[model samples]
Target: MYVIHLRYTGALAEIDDALEAHRLYLGRQFDAGAFIIAGPKVPRDGGIILAASMDRDRLDAIIAEDPFSQQRLAHYDIIEFKATRLAPDLNLPQSPWL
Candidate 1:
């Protein structure tokens, strides 16, 4: 029900390291059923989008633990909003309504 948009602004050399951490973080979130979908932007854009829990506190905790934040590898600008609509391709097996 919430999406996190993250932007990376560090040296390009750090991308690989940053991605490793991101992968672990995403794995944890997925296993915990906190994150719905997450991935990097196309064209190698320095950004990623993560769809996550509806709870702001939970989302904030997850972001705080991000490797990008811990290693100072990237800066993040997060926006929290209700998903008023979703694409037909959107999948939510965990969602009660779904």
Candidate 2:
């Protein structure tokens, strides 16, 4: 699993300009099952994305497609981790062994 943390590097106006494109890109990723959950941060400065079922290289390639990356509106910090457990009601591909 992976947690993609994005921090805004550009001004809010610049970020807004590319928001739609970024959302469209996210939509495509979700459709392809490359992303599980995504949304803006509390202060609206950046965002977070939960992704799984892929390797780091593949995830990097996908992140490269995000408009934020293409426009240099944000910086991404990718953290890879192993899933150890989940709540009983939560279901994810990584839950198979749970």
Candidate 3:
């Protein structure tokens, strides 16, 4: 699993300008089963994305396609971790914490 944290680096106006395209990019990823959930931060300064486990290189390429990244409007902090647990409703493979 991965937590893709995006911190806005451009002005709000600039971020807004690219928001639509960014959303489209997210939608594509979601359709491809790369993203599980995504939303803006509480302060609206950035966003968070929960991504399904995948190859690091593939994830990087996906991130690079984000409009925020293409426009250099945000900085990304990609945190990868082993998911030792999952919600009952989520059909992930059983882990130690299951």
Instruction: Report the number of the highest-lDDT candidate.
Output: 3
Question: TM-score of model 1 relative to the true fold?
Answer: 0.76
Per-residue lDDT of candidate 1, residues 51-79 (tens digit): 55456676677778988778777677767
Residue-by-residue lDDT tens digits, candidate 3, 1-98: 88999999999999999999999999998888888889999999999998888888989999999999999999999999988877878884322212
Each candidate structure's TM-score, on Cα atoms with residue i matched to residue i, is 0.76, 0.90, 0.89
Q: Once superposed on the true structure, which residue ranges of model 1 sit more than 4 Å away at CA?
A: 87-90, 95-98
Report how far residue 69 has shifted in candidate 3, in Å. 0.2
- Which residue ranges in model 3 land beyond 4 Å of their true spot? 92-98
Q: Name the lDDT value of residue 79 in candidate 2.
A: 90
Residue 35 of model 2: what lDDT?
Answer: 80
On TM-score, the candidate that comes out on top is 2
What's the ranking of the predictions by TM-score, best on top?
2, 3, 1
Cα-lDDT of candidate 1: 0.70
lDDT of 2 by residue, 1-98 (tens): 78999999999999999999999999998877788889999999899999875767888999999999998999999998887888999986442212
Order of all candidates by lDDT, from best down to worst?
3, 2, 1
- Residue 5 alpha-carbon offset, candidate 1, angstroms: 1.4
Model 1: colliding residue pairs = none
Quantify all predictions' global Cα lDDT against the true fold. 0.70, 0.87, 0.89
Candidate 2 local lDDT, residue 46:
92
